[model samples]
Target chain A: MNASLFDILTIWLQRPNFIAFIILFLWGLYIMIAHHNLIKKLIGMYLVQTSVIFFFITVSAKAGATVPILLNGESVDPALYANPLPHVLMLTAIVVGVATLGVSLALVVAIYRQYGSLDEEVILKQLGE
Target chain B: MRHHLPVFVFLLPFGMAICMPLISLVRPKWCRGLTMLALAAMTGLSVMLYSHVIAQGPIRYALSGWMPPLGIEWIVDGLSGLLLPLLGSLALMGVWYAGPLVTEGKGSIHFHLLTLLLVSGLSGMVMAGDLFNIFVFLEVSALSSYALVGSAGGRALVSAFRYLILGTLGASLYLLGVGYFYAVTGTLNMTDLADRLPDLLASKAVMAGFIFMLIGLGIKMALVPLHGWLPDAYVDAPDSVSPLLAPLVTKVALYAVVRVMYWVVGGEEVGETLPILTLSSWLGAVAALVGAFLALSQQELKRMFAYAGISHVGIIVMGVCLGNPTGFAGGIFYLLTDAVMQAALFYIAGTAFYSLGIRTLADLGRLRGQMPWVIGVLIVIAISMIGIPPSGGFFGKWYIILGALEAGNYIVVGGVVGATLLTLGYFVTIFERIFVDSVSSGPAVLAESPLSMRATMGMLAAASLVLGLMSDPMIRLILDHAFPG
Candidate 1:
């Protein structure tokens, strides 16, 4: 059991795409928390959403898989075709993410127009008054 | 036609919302009339659906004639059956109360459209049988609410922006959690996931998914630490929007939490395999105490009520985490009663602001004499908020206490009692200032609200009493069908 666990850990470490996705997700979260600029915060939000999209795409991929579309007269093995459901779901998610980004950008514009600053601290101070 | 009730319940509002902008261009009066008409129709349909569920069992409707795991399905079970009518009626009352307020606003047409859309989204969230569908509906409601909040402009814009950022982050987290579930179970259908989840309960991915989902929903429901956006959003939103949102948004989120826990995750894992329930119970206890204290410190009426809402949410969460039918029943009862009480209170605040042009407690200076009906209703609602007997709030608290005692959760029982006392402390102070104190020199000019607003407030205030009297039957219905052992 211990040896198998170690093998799984090693294999996971070698998956660079998964590692990159994790790093990007964390970096996006960090920027969302650490940045004061509202626009930059929205960019961070987009990055977080993009990372999830990447994660979904990675999960749907197979080492030897071909496109999911089938030929008219051919019998195809399911194993040779990549899963298409996750891709479709991610497409919906990407649209949702884009819509959310658009709304957030509009809100930022309104905030800037009102308060004359996009900095979190400045907005907070103004709101306090 | 009856078979199509589930879809019609949501589709009516959605269709009307889509047509509202065009309708408003032709006749703005028609827009308001159409919104109320849609709500009334939904209320009637929900009542029909609820009775059908009680007579039979769960009703499942597949979109486009496709079955579950392939096409989206809507389930009107005992839970949704109870909630649907509650949501529909409350929305009707909200619209009735917002009539004058909406007409006063510049974007009256848009406001009506968003309100309809929000109601559609809420109904969809409750009825949806698929996991991803819930997320979609949640975003629909969240996005519309953000726009509604920002429609008030000025400070509301900032508050709504904050809400949008945090709400989007929460929704994204929820989606990530859903992705985990999909990766493991290879299905998005809730019932299908339930069948697959038992064997995978011990898996790290499933556990991570549970935690992520909990945190995400916790933010949406404004559970203490993650509740930073709630007060600002509620207090800064427009008068009409505040009452509508205050009653529904978090309650719907709580409904989703209950649905996922009981239906999808199942109670066994929530009880035995993980300490999540216990942790939530403790978090709730702390939230109750902290929320009550924070509410006591606020001078603004709406802001104080927002904090008090957090406290009541804590109580409901504690009830749910007890992991028994009795506790679950208590949670549902509290949710229903709290919706009426909070809506009534916010309506009063809105009316007060509309009439007297102020919401600060200091400025309220004994105008109860002029607007006696408003003050009277306010007193009754405030008493209910403190969980006084013969009001719906009392029965909810009583059941929660009984459930806590049954579970031997003395700490939670103590927290509930303490929270009640704290509730009384703030509410009593407001009550005295309203009824007992002399009218101060401050602007004492009092203008009565419209008859419609008063009637809506009176009806909801009466509901608190009527529901309290009927709580035994209500609890029995909830336990026998909603949480059958």
Candidate 2:
């Protein structure tokens, strides 16, 4: 039991990628909530999405693994190949992220044209007036 | 040919939506006709599929001829069979009501296109049997709705932006949960996940996954504190946009919650192992009270109705969290009834805005004399919203109260009753304005609504009455087959 506990501790410490991913996610969330500018919010949204992508890629990684692609004449061993599903899924997620960014930017442009400000507080005040 | 009904129901709308831009360039008048035709066909298909499912059982179709655990699948069980027909009919009504209003402008084509896409996305969400596929369809629906809300321009732009930000956050959280599940189990199929989840119930990652998913979908369903975007999006949207969105979007999100909790994760874990259901029940009770109280303060008609919608959503959530078959069926019945009632109310509000320029209680005082038909329908819908006898809303509340009593949950029963009285309180204000107050002396600037709009509103109002009278059969049908026994 003690050995297993130590093993868990070692694995947790070695997984710095996961820690970085969480930090990036929280940082993005903070910007999204705290920033007054709409553009900054959109940028923060992009950062949040990027962190998710990074986490997925990190999850797909295996120690002592090679590329997922197969060599034509080589004998195949499944344990040596990294999982490919997360990469494919993240590709779709990236496409969805781009589409969302496009829509959000268009909306910001329209809001800027109408209220003449990108700050949410200014826009709300103008709308009230 | 009959086996492909699930695919065709969504595919038909998607195909028509994609073809709309070209059709608009050639003949714009045909755009409305085509959209109506597509929704009507989808309605017919859903009815046929529901009948088939009742006769046989759940139908699962594997995409590209690959079986489950390998390829994407679409399933039409009791839940989807019931919801698909409701969604199709309501969407058809939304389009029919918007026909005359959208036709008067240049952007009518785009409106029809976005509306069709929204319908397709909703249909896809209901029928999808895979978790990842649900996310894809969710994005499809969310993206289209954000654009549809902003299609009116002006103040709608800012509201739509807020919706976009929050909606994307919700979607991101959901995806992160899905990622966690994949990391642990490496499967996305709902049935497969259900099979694997029993053994993994003790894992922290699995627990975190369920928590993340519930919170994400909670925001989408507008459960109280996370409902900041709904009133603004509904109020500032175009007159035609609110009716389509107000009834369907949040309900679909709730459907997703049902699918995830009962199907993917299994209710035993959610009820016994985790405190999710108990927590949801408390939150739902609080939301029911808070939403109704907030509704009491709104002066505008649509904003008031929007708050009332939040209250109804809370009631349905509370019912589902009871973790019993009776409670689950009550939740489904309330969902059906609320969709009909809320859509009819929004349609009436839209009609009032279009025909009489009515926005507040004062504007409604003189409306009785000019537009008796619209005002009459509004009264029936308002009564239903207050859960009066002989209306669909009463039956929904009745079942929920019975379920809560059976579960020995007295606080929830009290919450339901208190919410009902508060609902009556707010709706009575509208009643007094329409029925008792004297007409103002100002000249009438608008005429009565077109025949199509009135006819659709009348049908929806009648549906509420009919559904109330037929509540027993509806409950039986939903209870017998919805969740795995």
Candidate 3:
């Protein structure tokens, strides 16, 4: 029950992962916000999106866990495997993200042909102003 | 036998869509035939599901023979069961209208494939039992929508791309929220998640999940501040794609938002803990008012209708936000009526464009004499859209008002009344020009839109009127069996 040094040290160690998550999130936000070029913005968007996927994978990973698939009782145990749902979900999401990137790249290609630049500023200026 | 109707309703269109590409290669023209057949089958299946839900209570279908809390499950409650049929009908109209309208050049193939894919995605969203499944189908719908929106012209391509980015963000937020929920609950089945949410409601992670999902879905639903992508997307999408995209896609997204708030998140229990109900309802009111007034200012035909849709969406959202069963019913009824009525209106509008080259309301003057039937059909559809008596639109608005009054939510009651007036303010202008006084010389010698187009418009118009008369029975069906415990 005492607030011992060992207990405080353990809590502080756990804090690092949370800090890392926050850093990744901010990094993604920066890419999305600071970038003006559409392709660069998309790459930033993907990085931000993947950061969430990374969060899922990290959070779902159990200490000393193996792959999710089951084997003979002697070697594999249910508790040892990392949670598979988030991984499975992230897999589907990656496929969707890739499909979206393809569609977006195609659109950017068209936008470039018409507006002659991938920069959002230039395209809007030419189209509207 | 009747209990299995929801399963078939989803399966028929989906299977047909999957097979559509291969079929398109054989007859080419058969793609239209195939699409029509598939829509017809879907309509038939929806009717069966409607009746089955009414008589026997909500039908629950477990996907892959897995029960909820363990495997995915599809529940066709009154809310969703009703949507299935409405979606099928609008889709049927879209395809019927598309065959004659899609440009003859390179646009034709892309048009048919995207339409079929959109249908599949819409059907899947309505029937999906799990959060992940809903997200999957949502993407399918959104992707096809991007392609369809881009199909009209180069500008449409730009608008489509914008929508594509925004829609992806919405879907990604939803996926992230679902991931958080699954991390906490160890399940994705909606019913199971509902059972599990209360335990995790206090967790900071779950709170973040809720925030992301709410904002994400709000954007997709075009709620107020998040509606940036909609007007352009709706306006710029080709005439053929407008009717479907205008009514069905947005309504389905709204349904998803409502589903997340109500059933999946467990309604009053969860709503009470957060300000979602209050914020959403207030925003809904703002949306309704803003959307209507802005609509009145637009000169282009489709653009004005697009704003009107945003207004009506506010009304529907208001009903959902009231967080009462009656309010929910009213909201859903509005969706059903709005989809059919709006689809009819857009078809007639598109007919005008196809025949007379009138894209703006200003050009509509010359059209008065050229296409009286189109004019007449539009007048009827517009009257219904304005929620006059003896139209399905009337019944839908009536129930929502009844729900609002019962909840003693006088603000919403007033909002509903004000919106109705606003609705009239905009639509009546169009009606007067078309019906009462021709903008040009004496009633012009009007040539009718093509037979198929006329038939499709006529069918939707007839449904609007007939559904009004049948409103009582439908209400009972929706409230009793469709949502029974």
Candidate 4:
């Protein structure tokens, strides 16, 4: 039983990409929830987005697989090549991510201009809301 | 033209959204007519497409003539057929009415641009046949709304930021869910997912995908506890934005919910393999009760409508999640009426505020003369809100209650009746204050809203009555194609 548990743990830990994603996502969520600074929260959002993008890329990666480019005069074994669809989709997601980042930063600038601070607690207290 | 209807429905607006700013740069005055013409053209095309889809089966358009599983697909079926027309017209009417009120000078360009983008995004969302495509459109619509929500400046900027954060999180969760689905099946198309999903019901990935999707959509639907961003998003948006979004945004999200839950997940599988559907019904019931009570306690007019929208969302969720055909039929039809009713009420609020600075129940109640036209439309709204006969709202809740009865969910039935009674209570007070009370604090001779605002309000109020008359056919059409073998 002890040997089996260790094996299972090793299997889960083998995927370095998944592990990295979890850490990044959790850290981002923590900042979003725990940080009172608005800019910090924005950073958290970016981290979360990056983690998701990382996850998409990870799902498309394969062991011993070459890029999805078709070589001349070679019979195709689909499994021998990394999947290209998720990569294409992620490029779209990346554009969306950039757009949201731009929009949010614009919003942050607007908030700072009006309230003169980037702290949530301070702004709310100022509003007496 | 008919062959390309599915693509043209959204492409027209998206192309026009791009052009609006350019046109404003040169002939600024022409932007108004272009905006109206674009929306009108989209609405007309949607109606024509709906009829075509009804006669012929689903219309499927592949990008660049590439077939599905390789190229993206856009489909117009019975479900989207019904939605496109309703969403298009409501948007057209909303922007039309907003022109006189909120679209003033330099800012008008951005306003029209964002509104058209919203239209384009919603149209794409309605027609998108792939899960990832839906996500793309979802972000498109969401980004535009985030911009619109803050366009009013001042306090609205804060609400827009909060909405952006919450909305982005929800959408990302949905995208992750799509990744999970794609990882397992290697396909993003809805019909392909449906075919692949049943065999993998026991897979953990499938379970994760479904749960993630439900939670994401729940946030978008603003189902009770997840509704933190909703009230402020609606209440703090520019006056014109509120009228367009307040009535329409959540309903489009509901369209997404229905699409994913039934079209992608399949029917009996949802009940047998999942308890989340049941959870949705209970949460919906609780949200209905809580939201109604909250609306009852509000003094501000728009906030009250915002909270009430949450309540109706709860009812609609309960309706569609019943896992019965009757429930879907009822819940789906009810949302149509609810969307219309919501638009009518917000138009009234907009008209009142722009005309007489009316913001509270008492303020609206104390008005004496001059809104003779408004009084007639107000009666229609009050009738629909109270669930009386010959109004669309009445039939929607009736079917919901009847559906709840069929499902043996006594709690949901009570939620429907209880919220209705509560709404009746407040609406009556407003009426009594208006018609019964002798005191009059409104201006001695108050001026009515512009002709355009009044005309739009009248048009929407009249639709609720017509929708009630039309509910039977609508229900039948939904049943025929929405759940096909």
Candidate 5:
């Protein structure tokens, strides 16, 4: 339940990517759970997913490294290039996020067509459940 | 060719999935035949793969001859080898039962297409040796299953939407956890992670990472306190989809937990830094109790079975968390047998919905004498679920309870055994309503389920029976493949 000053400072300032990820994740979780409108809930989901994508990109970053490309005329030093695995992994994550958004949005459309409302309480009321 | 069986399990279905749209274009009718051929091949390939794994040990195939720590990898050990055949056959049976119910509506091809994709995703999840690859396959399976659940339209759409939110949340958390571990170990391969995790287990970041994965897969597995999406999804899913989604969706998540945590992280025994195992076993206990009690109050059969599923998942996880070979084997045994039994039960549920319009518990009273011999199969399955001897469910629980006793975890012991009595209460209530209680309304004569439907259900029920009666060899098979080298 308690942390040292070093831990606090690390969380607040040093680990920019992790701190930002935590904030965005909790914010999005709030919007997704507390919002009544289905569209807003989906927006919240997007924020959470984007936060994850950012975190992965953070993992791939290095201060003095070039892009993960091989130079035709130069010998390769791995440390000169930023890690590409995390970046490549994020591309797949981004596609999956978009695909899920599409599916959820289609479901929202179907719900609206059936019940004429996007508000959770309103739809549940209409269903009398 | 036999050596390629592991990759073939995933690629066959994926290739068939891509070919589906084209087949529908050239000849819509051929879609069904193509689907049957694809799954039959997948199942056959998996059976061969299982034998190979048993004989030759775990198979790890590196893509393009690149060895693990850098390139993508796929591994099928004892546990995954057993599950592949079971899930493949479930898909095969699911298609046969779904044959009559799948309407020739516009884009009927979507049904078969999504089914194949789901199977492919599931197989990929089972075999994936890379953490990020597992996440990708998890999404593929989740996305396809969403479309399948919402395929019935209307209320099903609403349920699917809610599941989407929770499912995406779960995936993001899982990815975050993977990132945390990668940060610590600088690797994503399971074998590499295991080698690095022991020393890092005491680090706060690694502990947090473990909790994140637990929460993430918890949502996916529909554990108690995080199961808000499951019952609604199951009840509202199309009858055709339930047979596939109900049995495999949560079961696979449970498998991921066992594979990653115990198989990779070395369970609680390997790392003494945290009592995360004990903590999870308690959570499983709570889930078992809460799920059973809620199931007791359900008036609809599908809804009841959904709650019961939550309880069984809890029991299986509890077994695995015991950190012993007997318990792990029991968990695997229950998982394989339960997939077959749940698939068969959902088929009967679909039959009732499609033909008899029997949705409520009261509607079962009319099935007294007029019902086809399918009632006999239902009795067999219900008895197994009730944990009677000579049935799969009984032996599964027996090993779990025995393991719990050995570990002195009385709470888990109570939860596992107490659920059996509650299970009896529900099954007896259903039977009493069917054969004993007098019907108040409904039709006097009942329509019979098709021979194909009846035949599939009978086969699965018999499999459950055989799984229990023949527990010795099967348990030995599981132990040999899944445990110490």
Candidate 6:
């Protein structure tokens, strides 16, 4: 309610949100670039994807907000809650993301059976120069 | 009830795909026949849907009676309507071409089942109005495509795996974009998100959304620099599978871009105000020329077609990036014509490979005098690719040029012209070998193609010619009412 605490809260909100998003983004990128195993790379990609979800959830938050459900037969105040829509969308995204991972893993398994290795470098070598 | 064609566009294939696996219980032959019938039915329904949309304007059907912005919806304007028929016709033709080949491979019932799922997924991707729903079907198409690609065994398995890795990255990026859009606008429905995005135009999350979505769709569309997966996937995929996968899968991905760009992103309205407008258009132009150059250099017949497919995608995107209605319609028309012609061309290529055992263009010289019928089919398809008269390819290129000129974007026009000329160059090489010279028959003489194969090629070649003549109504339908500017 007061200016001093409000200023502190806003600063706190912006910094941590920004920091969390950056860390997740970098971590996901690292796995994608560094992991050589096809399945591990896929897992890394999914982790990178989850990091983005983390970014969405964090940025969508409001300071001092409660959960976004109707409680005690009363409509909750908008200012006191993070939006539920993004969270719901993220859930759907997570489902799709997982499904994609499953498919990719299935392909990887098939690849291993055929090529006898999951290393990206080796597969490319076998394919051609 | 006719206003609800959008729902049927998706549901018909979906319902049929669910039941296709069970057909194995009756008999393998029965399964193939039933699958063919289902795809044919889908084709007929889509043509009807196209006519309906042309007459009545875009048909919007909210899922389960819930309104959009609150629930998922399906939109079938000229764009989706145009795409539905293209998807259906290609699937039907591909199945017809593939049926015998599967028997040749002695593939199991799962082969037909995966193909059905691929069709359902592609149809759903085109018709879906919600961003996340598109992702669901996108995965369906991608997963099934992976299986279809790998079913050839040996080297195809590696190619499919590589495609899977790249494809998963693309999907992840797309999901990342969706997350960003949700963070900014709190909705995944394209129409609602478009309406809401303006309010968050300056938000960092929205910027991230634009980048993520563009990169993701670019990978799926197999644009330049992101197209590493295409050649192998198309080349190593079975002779039966390449035509279906190459023509429709990437085209559908491009359709997704158009949907997000024009309808969902509000085209010029959002582009002029956005950060990525200039960059996206520039990337499209670059892809057009680069893809063409890559295509011109390939010696393998199927790989050449794959590169040509990417080049055409670049041209379509170039037309799109012009940000005008004519440009949009031209892009859509190119999409339709390209899918038809490319599939037909690939089908002929596969036929040659099957009948002659010739995989490289250099080796094709051996079949020069041996296969007149196949050579004639190739000439027709090649003429279309070269944008010669009396072919749909010419009209597609004309509109793209017209759009670039309308926008005063000479660079894009130049790219289109160069790609067209390159198209002529590569296809002409094949033509000269086919007709201008003769080769002595080898120990393994060429065999005449079966009636089924000949009938399919003749039908596709005929459709290419007829589609060229039918452009007047098709152009007006997509350009006039579907997107009123």
The top-ranked prediction according to lDDT is 2
Q: Model 1 off-target regions past 4 Å?
A: A1-9, B104-106, B436-439, B442-446
My TM-score estimates for the predictions, one after another, are: 0.97, 0.97, 0.92, 0.96, 0.97, 0.92
Between candidates 2 and 4, name the one with more favorable lDDT: 2
Badly placed stretches (over 4 Å) of model 6 are: A1-13, A60-72, A75-82, B104-106, B199-204, B274-278, B436-439, B443-446
Candidate 6 residue pairs in clash (backbone atoms < 3 Å): A65-A80
Off by over 4 Å in 3: A1-34, A74-77, B1-8, B104-106, B432-443, B483-485
Interface RMSD of 3: 1.5
Interface root-mean-square deviation (Å) of every model:
1.0, 0.6, 1.5, 0.7, 0.8, 2.3
lDDT ranking from best candidate downward:
2, 1, 5, 4, 6, 3
- After the best TM-score superposition of candidate 3, give how far the Cα of residue B83 lies from its true spot, in angstroms: 1.5
**What are the per-residue Cα lDDT tens digits for candidate 3 across B21-43?**
67766666666777778888988
As a TM-score, model 4 comes out at: 0.96
Greater-DockQ candidate between 1 and 4 = 4
lDDT of each: 0.87, 0.88, 0.79, 0.85, 0.86, 0.79
Q: Give lDDT: candidate 4, residue B22.
A: 82
For model 1 the local lDDT of residue B229 reads 96
True contacts kept of 1: 0.47
What's the TM for model 5? 0.97
Off by over 4 Å in 5: A1-7, A71-73, B105-107, B269-271, B440-446
Measured with C-alpha atoms, the lDDT of residue A115 in candidate 2 is 88
DockQ (C-alpha based) per candidate is 0.68, 0.78, 0.48, 0.79, 0.88, 0.50
- Give the least accurate 10-residue stretch of model 1 chain B, judged by summed lDDT: B439-448
Cα-based lDDT at residue A48, candidate 2: 92
Tell me the lDDT of model 1 at B119: 94
User: Taking the tens digit of each residue's C-alpha lDDT, what string does model 1 give over A45-89?
Assistant: 888888888887887888988876657877577789988988988
